[model samples]
Target: MASKGKISIIGSGLIGRNWAMLFASVGYNISLFDIDESRIDDALVDIKQQLNSLESKNLLRGSLNAEQQFSLIDKCISMEECLRNSIYCQECVFEKLELKVQVFQQIDKYVDDKTVLASSTSCLLPSSFSANLNHKSQVIVAHPVNPAYYIPLVELVPAPWTDEKVVARTRELMTEIGQKSVTLKKEIEGFLVNRVQYSILNECYRLIAGDYVSVEDIDSVMCDGLGLRYAFMGPWETAHLNANGMKEYFEKYSKGIYDVSKTFGEIPKMEGATADHIANELTSRIPLEKLNERRKWREERLIAITQLKKTLDKH
Candidate 1:
């Protein structure tokens, strides 16, 4: 855990490129590594295109032009070249356990003693990949939400053997790159955010499957109701602010919430009629022929929302 300076990114995919943009935007020299040399070339192209997109939209940080930002990203052809003199490394490889294990083993072999080795794994835990490595204590999951170039919530998940010092340094480094991080005290399946997301998803599935709502209507409920409020306050904070305080809110709603929770049905298999409904509604809004255009629209909308959130927080 040297202070944030030179950083390395392994697996230059979507998340990897985002991590590189994040660090480089803050003036860190970055080494980006990937097995396919062409992927490095492609990532460099994609990142510049992405940075230019942000620049046009005034979403990127710093005053660097797209060319200057592109220059900060060095395509490291070898693992040795990638880790050389790097203070920290962020792994954004695929989510498979074996693939992660293999990558971590190689990374541990090349990493400096003080370098913090972090993963952008959404599912695999640190112990699942780094347990047997010599640099195990330095390894942890620093999972980022996609479009990390704009939306910057990094979930800091440390395994049982991951050192406290390493976690602190990781959190500090992420903050330096203008990323918000929440540290998990103990490892849990899907971590905090994904678990909460999955709970809502399960309920959405049940609602659609039980014929209580259409798939499109279910999504509209979130977009029109819960999601708008979530832009300002989290569920717990909303509960606290709704009444006098958290205690009073819980006292009044505990039984009701519990009863509703108990009455919730099991998750649907999502294979037959439910799947058809979802497909029909989703395709209506975003036809397969226009998927790429729709994806761009979604990303832009998220970026706009993120900008709005920043403006609101400033006041």
Candidate 2:
């Protein structure tokens, strides 16, 4: 397959590896790098295994087979080598603000003005680390959910100085690789996903602390109920469908919703006995030693959902 372009992956961790695979599967040449060169080798092995496993299950992305996609990714011994001739650079380094700032500063020195510099940060705003960079206008955040390859949603959050063209090109690239992209008009702390996620977490913690619900029951409220609809539609769309329309839905239930909201307790600190209780309950159900096994189980389910979505969309 012809190469789309070169994509530089600045970290060899899970997110970086997944990014490399997603780009490589779509015919982009990938330069995978990490400070620890040995980790790069390990990541390549894991990527190979993952691609082959996906291929065996008939869930491999893009037209390229596992071997072909694996061949497009090469290990880089230095940051400059990885960034050289790349059209886009994705920084997946540790989430610490200081570390991210240093990495971007170093990347700014090597990348040309045209390269789209994106970070895979889940929460930290793009401006926080990219503000002091020489190429701040080229920086943006392209946060993806865990198991990015299967989840497919990429949040595109731009810094204030980020060029409009950079954001457009990044979204275009994301589309080209078969990922869904949502753009934020302005930078916000925690972006979109985490803010909504933390809101739910706050209520869950409050309920547990008040002894109003068990940890398992709270999880079931999501996985067994809300999650069923959420997998295909968001909250607003779900509400719209529940009644004749969004207007009617709010008119019918808005007062009751407002009344319940007023009665909800303040956010509970996620520590002390409540944390211990939740942790103990979860650990008993899925022991620490079996976490990796459970993660694979989760991935399998995500892949199934991904396949289902594809089939449903085609119909």
Q: Which candidate achieves the best lDDT against the true structure?
A: 2
Alpha-carbon error at 121 in model 2, in Å?
A: 0.9
Worst 10 residues of 1 by lDDT: 1-10
Error of 2 at 240 (Å): 0.6
- For candidate 2, the 10 contiguous residues with the lowest summed lDDT are 262-271
TM-score of each: 0.94, 0.97
Runs in model 1 deviating more than 4 A are 1-4
lDDT, candidate 2, 115-168, per-residue tens? 999999997899999988889999999998998988989999999999999999
Best by TM-score: 2
What ranges in model 2 sit over 4 Å off?
A: none
How accurate locally is residue 238 in candidate 1, as Cα lDDT from 0 to 100? Answer: 90
- Total colliding residue pairs, candidate 1: 1
lDDT of candidate 2 at residue 99, scale 0 to 100: 92
